[model samples]
Target: MDAAFIHDNLEIKFLILYIAARVSRPIPVEGMQELTLCDSGIDYFSFSQCLNDLVRTEHLTLSDDGLYAITPKGLRNSEICESSLPMSVRLLTDRNVAAYNQMLLRKEQVRAQVTPRKNGTYTVTLHFSDDVDELLHLELMAATRDLAQGLADRFQKNPEQFYTRLMDTLFPKE
Candidate 1:
């Protein structure tokens, strides 16, 4: 209705497109919400609506895996309208997207393996490694494949937390 309200709404939509454009890989909805809503103070409902609108308008595509990526039209729109956004907002978006991408890379590097054993059991091996060396390698036997897969999924989600808890449990200080 009012000029300021319309401008703010456009800015938010543009900001979302800008982020999707800058990232190398598709960003999941939760990641986008975490960055925009939690880190940038955008209202959760507004942010979700903006994302949905972008998808509906063909500015963004929601992938089969549920990740959002900017379309060609969205990229063009960002290139043209990005200068209208505040410098502070632009800088914050860039930094947050970079950090989010780095986290995704780290998650990808963490490996999980599920193996079916001859004894009608499953073996789940969790590994956390970097460029040089393997930081952790743990194996657990599961009575069912579902259990093994669940452990693998959980480990992949937050290996650092899992490692820290394991260390704290095993080497409790006196």
Candidate 2:
């Protein structure tokens, strides 16, 4: 939760993992930056530096084909940080891929059948399976909107507090 941790370097790292987890593919740097951001303004030097730092620090692993994925260390660290707050946080790995894919498929199927409201927002319907805890299709927009709620919770409780704690954990800003 460190604001500094949310800086360009960390954001890029998270974005990489998020994209990899979602696509379930080992994404190249070019594709990752291009697809996930509005602009690939991050310089190659800086991006490679971040990637190297994370890899050297054991946060990510890169394939011979230039595909990148989170390391066990990275995944564990992210889960620990996410578990600090209540959110839709979950572990991403091969074991969870099947369930995640099924859920994603259901979400897509529901989205196709919905009509948008006057505000141009559509409701996502959910078809439940015994495996999932909830039976609700989450539209992309709705899911993004709800993304901030967890962040807001941290802010209300003093945004800097968690950041400070994270800073101590990561950089130990003494």
Candidate 3:
């Protein structure tokens, strides 16, 4: 209705497109929300609406796996209108995107889980994997949930050490 309202709406849509174009990867909705809504102070409802509108208008594509990627139309639009966005906002988006990328890499390489057993114990599973194969998969039983969680946390923090120690114990060199 008003000029300011229209400008804000257009900027929000452009910001979404700018982020998707810059990331150059399929980003989950939660990741986008983290960057736009949580980190950048964009209204959650507005962000969601813009995302849906982008997809509906074919500016962005949403995969069945729930990741969003910018379409060619979105990329072209962002390239043309990105200067309207403030440099500060662009820098903040870049930082958040880098952090999100690091988080994703860490998630892919290491994993831990704690499961409670019916026998009043817990099972802690620690896993380390690469793109093609699993490098390590260790399971330990702990008497208490705290202990189980602690083990899981330690494993996640330093899976390489655990894997090395396991190898050393299993095959001592002469």
Which of the predicted structures, 1 or 3, would earn the higher TM-score when compared with the native? 3
Off by over 4 Å in 3: 1-7, 38-41, 113-125, 130-134, 138-153, 167-174
**Cα lDDT of model 2 by residue, 1-174, tens digit:** 111223366655554455455554555777555543422434555566776777788777788988777777777766545433212222322224455456455443332233345675544332222244533323333333244344333333443354456557978657
* Cα TM-score per model: 0.66, 0.36, 0.70
Writing each residue's lDDT as its tens digit, candidate 1 over 1-174 gives: 011222356778888888888887898888887766533445777888999999999999999999999999999998998887777777777888889888776866798999999999999988898768888988899999999999999999888899889899999988
Cα deviation of 82, candidate 1, in Å: 1.5
What's the distance in Å from true for residue 76, model 3?
2.4
Alpha-carbon error at 21 in model 2, in Å? 3.1
Model 2 misplacement above 4 A = 1-6, 39-44, 81-174
Model 2: per-residue Cα lDDT at residue 16 = 47
Name the regions of candidate 1 deviating beyond 4 angstroms.
1-7, 38-41, 114-120, 126-174
Clashing pairs in 3: none
Q: Report the lDDT tens digits of candidate 3 across residue range 1-174.
A: 111222366788888888898774699998888777533346778789999999999999999999999999999999998888777777777888888878888788899999999999999988898778899887889999999999999888988888889899999998
Query: At residue 110, what lDDT does model 2 achieve?
Result: 31
lDDT of 2 at 12: 53
